[model samples]
Target: MTDMRNGSVTLLEVAPRDGFQSIDKLIPTAEKIAIVEDLLSAGVSRMELGSFVSPKAIPQMADMKEIAAHFKGREGCRMSVLVPNGKGASLALEAGYPDLVFVVSVSETHNRANVNQSVAQSLDQLRAIVAEAGDGGSRLRVDLATSFDCPFTGDVPLDAVRKVAGEALVIAPAAEFALCDTTGRADPMTVAHRFEAVMREAPDETVWAFHGHDTFGMGVANALYAYSAGVTIIEGAAAGLGGCPFAPGATGNTATEDLQFAFEQGGITTGIDRAKLLDTADRIAALPGGKTASHLRIVPRGRAV
Candidate 1:
């Protein structure tokens, strides 16, 4: 927990969950495992290992238990599993992940459309989840999705996003909170302004992270804006994987390679091996429809794969 306000940076690799789950073709479990392993080998210290929602809702994350079981106690790296509610949180605890991330959308329309729950309902679920995880000696984080703009409900009011984040923190009291631009509607100015506002209104030093999509092709710009605004932990996918099934035509996340490049070129140190990361991206590219959206793909650099 380095002081993010002190200019330290962290990147949470999100390809295994957010990246693969959006595509029509299901990436094999073995491949998913390999990707996670590869990312770890590349010096990515933290990763969004998997999600705990029902397989019916997101079949790609059905193997969460298996993945969680496999990642338990892997040295040096910390893995986080996403939980949608108390049930998912229980499953995460059962699977033995010490770190958990709970997601709640700020937009009512997006919340109902994504999880079939209202904002209040989702907060209530989060309270239960926090209690459950606390009983199990696990840590929890809350991600406020659609904090910027909502596809279903145009521009999401900043107040609504702030309120949901505050409720989540109150339930867990000390849980970390992240803001996500699910549909990638956040511009640089919007990202800077919103994140600054959240920092000002947050209770204590909130563990703030940014999850930005590349739908409007401004993912990198928004992320850079977030970085400039003092956000450290940035969630992104390898090979630019991930898109919203509900918000059709929305592009994938900011490519991990792209984000890394931005940080490295800007004189920021992430402790991640650029060559290894690019190699992993190439491995994904070799997969059917693994076509990468990152700029590194054109460089023809060699590492592995």
Candidate 2:
């Protein structure tokens, strides 16, 4: 059964990284920093702040280094950046970040297209990153992307996700594993069933995370299902920002405000201030093309002009 207690569940805000990357407008460094600061003040402990991918591919994240520099002295925040390869990993380490994250698609075709590397190649790189992180203040995590379904490949087999997850466990024994529904193709049933099955396989030494896209509007439902299935860490983006530029017709992520409201209303305490989160979402919506995917618009404190 899913654990829905205070200490049992954790949410990793992904708006700064996954959410902003998919947008066409360039979110200035100051604004990104301000948003993250707001979330931290609202009591979000862990957040995916940025990605270390090639600037050419994700121009939005090109300022990763600069942003990392800004957070150098911050406290009580576990900031992480997504690293695609050895180079990206090295950059993360050089930035003095204590945590690094890697993502690999469960679908072979999507893995190649997204990262220009095969599953094995990506796994090898992750292993190298783990080795480099060796006994430091930092930690490594590998997100098993497309665990639900792939845009390129119709349905990803559970066995395939398990296979790669197993291999990843060997390299980074202490690494956390995240099951990503990159295409938002996961339903509540699939989430509950598959996640329960996969959670059983997760090594006791590792933590488990769930990253669900809201492509089909099932993100929150799937998240609730995962929570019931023993997933502790839930990933979400602010303003539901993010979609694959290369992946056609891809939608944004599950909105942070909406998810927080759902959790709170469901009698689940996420230790987050819902009102503050809504305010943040509203601010983002005011930006150019910033109308977020969240429904908590027109907050009362501020005038809605």
Candidate 3:
């Protein structure tokens, strides 16, 4: 794993899971597979394809197993799925997903609303899940949602975020920690300071990533700040598709295309083909009720603004 803190960055494409989960319309399984294929073809190596939660909770992800089957045994791509609990982890195991993302919100109110568990209770459940996956060859990634701000509780305290992240590391020492801007309310300075604080509090080898939303149009800026503050992995959605169904005032994630453009323009390599990525963004936007918040997607590539 290259140190993202050193300058090299990796963008984890989260559209298939985070994006699709929020859509009201059910996208066909084949269409979902096609989009995943296009993303891979466009040089996106890491992707969150779907989640393993109950269909009733997130009907949009009902086809998780089918979607997993389509990409089974794929090589050269790091595929992951969001698992909210032990049952979700078991489902992902059965579906053959190797990477699982477990979310624990920093806000007590948001955690209760999102998963019906307090932070302590969720960590207990997460510990059990990690134990159950012992020697199963599955890797876990813990995401701290509302790490910066929460809709229900306004600004989250830095200590609260650090505590959750520290405890999460104890449960899965090798787990990657993603500091999420759930509502896109994080400013650049705050983002830099908080991330620096997290790195200091957590294990030196712990991989830190950023997941930002574009609700307030600061998604890209916040991400750049995160990168400068030593975060290497950044997660985003194709065509800016995302939002928390359980979160009030939540909106789309930073557009993957836009992030790639920003990184490349700053002389940072993301290994994504700009032209191919743009084409894939168009395909994503063509889906039913699909739209993008990527500025580069709307602007011509060669045109000087």
Candidate 4:
């Protein structure tokens, strides 16, 4: 069941990391920090600020260390960074981040393309990474990319996802899992069914999150269905800014404003200030190559455009 104790839903803003990483232009570190501050002011308590990856592969995230330094120890916000391996995890821990997300794809082909490793190899590396970060007090989360469908392999078997997730739990018993709709191929029904199955398999204390791309315009629907199936953590990017550089034909994630609007209308509280979030979305849209795919941002409520 969705946690409605305070009539609020947890939304992890991913624009600064996931959204900005896909842009061809380098976003200045100062600008990134300002945008993150604005998001915090708009009631976003959790955010994926950036990734600790090779600068050559993702130059946009070259300044993750600086960004992490800026937000470290800030009150009332939980900062998370994506770590690709043990080395990345070391950097994140050294930077004082309290949470880390490691991504692995269910489809072997997509997994190789995204991380240049087979599923077994990645898990082997993950075991080492988990051991290296052992009892570090930092929270570890696994993002099972291509859990729904893989661009290279087409449909991914639910069993494949379950197997990888099961392995991840064995390696990091305290880790959470975020099922990713990497190519936006998941519909509402599929989202519900898959989430239910995973939930049934996950440990009692395991936390499950949903990461959906909006390639086919069903991101919000899929997220809502996941929520219906006991998922409480949802990821989104402001102005729908993001795409998998490694996944061909993949698109931006669900727009933060769009998801907030949908959840609020459905009587789910997101704790986000709608007006402020829309304003932030507009600001993001004005950046170079800032054009977004969010319906609400393009066609907002009230007033003649």
Write the number of the candidate with greater TM-score, choosing between 2 and 3: 3
lDDT of each: 0.81, 0.80, 0.87, 0.87
- Model 3 scores a TM of 0.94
Give the per-residue lDDT digits (tens) of candidate 2, residues 154-177.
888889878988788778877788
TM-score of each: 0.92, 0.92, 0.94, 0.95
Q: Which of candidates 1 and 4 is the stronger one according to lDDT?
A: 4
lDDT per residue, candidate 3, 1-305, as tens digits?
Answer: 13442355799999998888877889999999999999999999899989888998889888889889889889978999988888888888888886888899999999999999999999987897787676322377888999999999899999999889888887888788899999988998899999999899877887889999998888999998899888989999988888988777878999998899888877788989888888888888888988877777766668732
What lDDT is obtained when candidate 2 is compared to the true structure? Answer: 0.80
User: Best candidate per TM-score, number?
Assistant: 4
Off by over 4 Å in 3: 1-6, 135-138, 299-305
Superposition error at 186 for model 2 (Å): 0.6
What is candidate 1's TM-score against the reference? 0.92
What is candidate 3's local distance difference test score?
0.87
Taking the tens digit of each residue's C-alpha lDDT, what string does model 4 give over 177-291?
8999999878988998998998898777888899999988899999988888888899999899999988788889999999998888777888888888877877787878777
